[model samples]
Target: MNYNSPHKGMTLIVKTITRITVGLILLYGIYITLHGHVSPGGGFAGGVIIALSFIHLMLAFGKEEALRRLPKPLVSLFESLGAILFFTIAILGFVGGYFFLDWLNKGEPFKLFSAGSILLSNIAIAIKVSFGLFGIFLVLVLLKFTPKK
Candidate 1:
């Protein structure tokens, strides 16, 4: 847990477990996001999963390594871009004379390719949620926790 030390964060056993689980966690996040339209899990939930995976990395390896993988600036950019993309899609629905309308072709039901706007919206939301949460975590991590003198 000493950030300055060569052996920074957790024990080797925890680090090894994290390395094994991280990819699975990320993949599960993607799966949840993609299946949002049909299932109960949606953009926000999936995004939380995704963010947790990164946060797990930070917890196991330390902030330095996690930040190296995903810099704050890049995460900020992704968050903003997600918002812009979400808004753009909403605005584009105006073309159909409705807000958040399904202007795009709606493919067959229950299939992966179905639910036109929902899919895109889920993606946008996932991006926003993941990066936004991660950014908050980073900000918290950077705070110097000094006890009262």
Candidate 2:
């Protein structure tokens, strides 16, 4: 059998398990990010989870597949977009005469939308973190790691 196939990576068992679990992992990450305001997990945690899912894919299915799903350019674009979004949100606070102010209406407490601008900030942070981490991972993987000559 040809071992150099782009689809080739880990063994069949690992591939099967990864295929099954990756979606669930991604969903769980989204859940943690969206419900962070009400729960303990927040943007950073959720973003790490999300990046791990992609990293898991890369490990199990090889970099080709993972990069195909989330190309490097798209990753950079998203990271920049996240920063822009966070900055824009902060700038909007200028209307309240301060930076990073909670300018939006705070909904009923303990509810999903209760955090107002915080929720948006969390989303922005998640976007930035997830993509930034994944991008860094890609760079490291591409780097030639050589031991002493």
Candidate 3:
């Protein structure tokens, strides 16, 4: 297994195209995640897109390459961390005497950096969903179903 070239799974054209578009896809996911509070899409949708980008890497290059980019241990770490972060954020609302309360100062409306903890909450959810979906995909890909003769 040549760790240098993860593009061995698909044809040259697919690999090239994936290499070019994967970044854009991931970036778009981030954009959707960030703009979720005001836009139609939210954290779950963005996270799925983000996970799709990684799956696209696996389809274009190979599982080894995708795993190289997102290892099992890291996935596990992020899974727990994201959950904890989200829980912590919700818990922080206790200062305002409520669960999942909006205590932070919400800036001007329609601005990129506005909405306070909403954006942070969206981010945490995105991280958790992305890692969870990606991990599920990896498991399915790794599953070896025996053929019945």
Candidate 4:
């Protein structure tokens, strides 16, 4: 209910630096998510990091501002779209005369853009999980404050 706190009005310099840092973290999370299949990170890890960035913003700016920036419906739509895209790519392999095909370009590992299908799937999962969690958080926060008739 009361998402705002007395500590919300923090110093401007700290807030500015934090906002920049969060932006960087979110970008890094996206990079990790997209490159997961070819590297150390993966969907879950990157998704959590992405969610954490938003959570930090929520803590800094309050739930109302965060919700305004990222509405629940948009998050849900993105989550659903990501899942659909991932599934569609997976199913394409079956229709392409192969079952469980990797669909990768078979380039050298550790390259900038290698491990095609796995990379794509990882991206999809990252988007789905991140937005899904955000949506859940929005629901829980709203429900906590929603007035019962």
Per-prediction CA RMSD (Å): 2.7, 2.8, 2.0, 4.3
Candidate 1 segments whose C-alpha is farther than 4 A from its true place:
1-6
Q: Over the stretch 1-149, how does candidate 4's per-residue lDDT look in tens digits?
A: 33334455345565677777989989989988987876789987898789888877876776777888898888889999989988887887885578657765767787867876887888888888888887777787677555789
In angstroms, give how far residue 37 of model 1 lies from its true place.
0.9
Clashes of each: 0, 0, 0, 0
Model 3 C-alpha RMSD vs. true structure (Å) is 2.0
Winner on TM-score (1 vs 2):
1
| Ranking according to TM-score, highest score first | 1, 3, 2, 4
In model 3, the runs with Cα more than 4 Å from the true position are 1-7
Candidate topping lDDT: 1
Q: Compared with the true structure, what per-residue lDDT tens digits does model 2 show for residues 28-137?
A: 99889988899899889999999999999999988777777799999999999999999999999999999988878999988888888988988998999999999999
lDDT of 3 by residue, 1-149 (tens): 46346436887788889978999999999999999988888889999999999999998888878888889889888978889989999999999999999889999999888898989989999999999999898989989999999
Could you give me the TM-score of model 1 versus the true structure?
A: 0.93
TM-scores for the candidates = 0.93, 0.90, 0.92, 0.82
Whole-model lDDT values for every prediction: 0.91, 0.89, 0.89, 0.78
Model 1 lDDT tens row, 1-149? 34345477788788889989999999999999999999889999999999999999999998788888899899999999999999999999999998888888899999988988999999999999999999999999989998999
How many clashing residue pairs are found in candidate 3? 0
Enumerate residue pairs that collide in model 4: none
